[model samples]
Target: MPSFTLPRAARITRITRTHKIAVAVLAAAGATSGLAVTSAPDTAQAASEHAPAAVKPVDAKGQPAKADDAKTGRAVTASVADHVKVDSVAKQHSAKQAASRSAERPAVKDYPLSIMKDKGIPGSYEGLHRNIMRESAGDPNAVNGWDVNAVNGTPSKGLLQVIQPTFDTYHVEGTPNKLTDPIANITAAANYAADRYGSIDNVDSAY
Candidate 1:
């Protein structure tokens, strides 16, 4: 079909008294669904008056802007841009948090007891020393020959009698990886005691 636009000046049709009489006759004829051609000029004029505006062209910058489009409503671009900005900030914050945690982690050492202050062990030095003495009599190479751990073939050893598996599980960072090494053994034992019984100083017997 061809589309035609009539000028505003041409839309005001000169209706005659004969047209009104004809409309009354059509109504009396009981027309059901046919167009009332007598009212065509007014309908055309109203449609032209309410027509939408044309889309505007883009400018030089790449940023999204409201196009002068014929749409009466604004585009939903602003909310989408805000969501992108929020996601970028969240990702940056997460990366910074991860970096900070990594920086705070302590490094491994040859002697764990040497880094007592560095590891920030919870109890006093004297208290920890007392617990170590009760467990192993200050001997780093002490071995429990008849204990449950020894019977199971994973014997307890060192200044603090810790079984291999238990020591490995609770082994603190910045400690030597040896069961007989006094500092490593003491630190790992303290860590295990702290986990189970609150602290090594709190253990009154072989825990």
Candidate 2:
């Protein structure tokens, strides 16, 4: 007797069922839930596995693990190096500014003793200093005898009692007051005494 054969679709269905059964058997041996799991080697399982460690930061003294390292929990060695460079630049700039300011300011040597001596009269400064001390006590605005002109009530000004005519003769250059300024009056008085009395020693007798 001859046996009956299934159609091509029916044969494919039978093959698919056999494949499914085989896969299910394999999954049951080594599967966890829906995932196929594999176990690591004994050596690998015993080895430490942790998060990547941060490098420690150093201080100015080259000591490892500084305050910044503690705060940020990161390596700040590069940042510390940059900070040093910035500080150096700032210091150099400050020094340059100080030097520039010093150069811009007026120098003490610009004013000289020779200039004062050339404009001043010799041998009369001491007498003038003494006379002014007695008369006005070196007061710049000292007035005497009220405001009379020629007779006896003439106005005496500054440290020295310089009259208007005498002030016109010996007043210093660039001065506002010929007789009202102490320094100018003193200088003018000295020059006048040097001319008239030949020295300040004879000025008291004339006065």
Candidate 3:
């Protein structure tokens, strides 16, 4: 009655309603397919994130495991067993080295009489020294005033009362005549004494 053609407003409303239904149906179908495809992966991820980490294994009695197990990331086990083994090997090596060195060390010998002779003191000088000590308290100038004509008589000529004959027998080439000259007298006396006794120890004992 108002108009034989549909009104403009009516037509727009019908198109809008059709589009809304189509969109709703498509949205519902998309949601269902997405849930089906992603469900397993989502469940797995959630379990991994929220679940506790795996624990290290323990013995039946709950004691800690051995060191090798600990090194491989297990808990409740000692971590130094390998180090202890290495230390034991090192200690054994050191002990062996020390023993080898001790075996290689040289032995020391006792002092020898030949060595003393080389040092300027002969083996036989011991008795002469003792006699001099007794007669003069070891004084080279000590006199025996009681004896008459005691061979030049100005006390003993040297450490061994060297008189003329003694001096000729044992005097060193460069020595002097004075009895007080310790070097000359000691040299002569040592040589003569050595000739008389086998060794200095024997002379020292007699003195």
Candidate 4:
């Protein structure tokens, strides 16, 4: 290796070069610091612009309220409750109507004309039926207070219009004592007619 020594001017030149490099480095650092300061606002502005907007919960219809979104579920429950109420009311009304109709049915259908024949009453069914129609219109509870038989205080009553005394006198065996008993009244009246007039079929007027 050859021994070397720097000239004074060369050394000075080298020192000057070093100084220039340091200045340049300082300048670059300053520039970088300035750039950082200037870019801070821009970075913040960019982030603000690109950030997501405030969001709210949406319904199926895209409305922003949670209550509106819950309405569909609420409607299903409400509809079922309403339907149940309606069905209950309808059933109650139907039951009431059926009971009313049953109550309103006429009581005349309780007995039939064939019952008279089965009782062995000696009378044509038509004549007995007509007599019943004229006296009580087939009403089992019919009573007569304005007739001559009732003026003596023992009123005529029941389907056959038999007075109390007559009912008691001619009442047939196996028949009820009550003058208002339909089958009993008919049997007693028929017995009375048969004893007096030979047969009920032979008499249609008051006995």
Top candidate by TM-score = 1
Residue 1 in candidate 1, Cα distance off native in Å: 99
Model 4 stretches astray by more than 4 angstroms: 1-121
lDDT tens readout by residue for model 3, 37-139: 8675677788899999866555434656566654564433343455567789999999999999877763211122233345555553345456556546766
Task: Kindly indicate the candidate among 3 and 4 with the higher TM-score.
Answer: 4
Q: Report clashes for each candidate as comma-separated counts.
A: 2, 0, 1, 0
What tens digits encode model 2's per-residue C-alpha lDDT throughout 126-184?
56556667767867787776545435655667666777678888776654565786556
Alpha carbon lDDT of each predicted model: 0.71, 0.65, 0.58, 0.75
* Candidate 1 runs further than 4 Å off: 1-117
Instruction: Look at candidate 4 and tell me the lDDT of residue 36.
Output: 91
C-alpha lDDT (0 to 100) for residue 57 of candidate 2 = 58
In the range 1-207, model 4's lDDT, one tens digit per residue, is 998999999999999999999999999999999999987768778899999997654543445545643555564455557778999999999999999988786344333234444555566566567777777888879999898877888888988799888898987666577889987777777777778887777777777
Per-candidate RMSD, Å = 19.7, 14.3, 17.4, 16.0
Model 1, C-alpha of 78: deviation from truth (Å): 94
Query: Which regions of candidate 3 are displaced past 4 Å?
Result: 1-121, 124-129, 147-155, 199-201, 204-207
- Alpha-carbon deviation at 124 in model 3, angstroms: 7.7
Output the worst ten-in-a-row residue range by lDDT, candidate 4.
Answer: 106-115
lDDT (0-100) at residue 68 of candidate 1? 44
lDDT of 4 at 166: 88
Residue pairs of candidate 3 with colliding backbone atoms: 123-200
Candidate 4 lands at a TM-score of 0.42
lDDT, candidate 1, at 137: 89
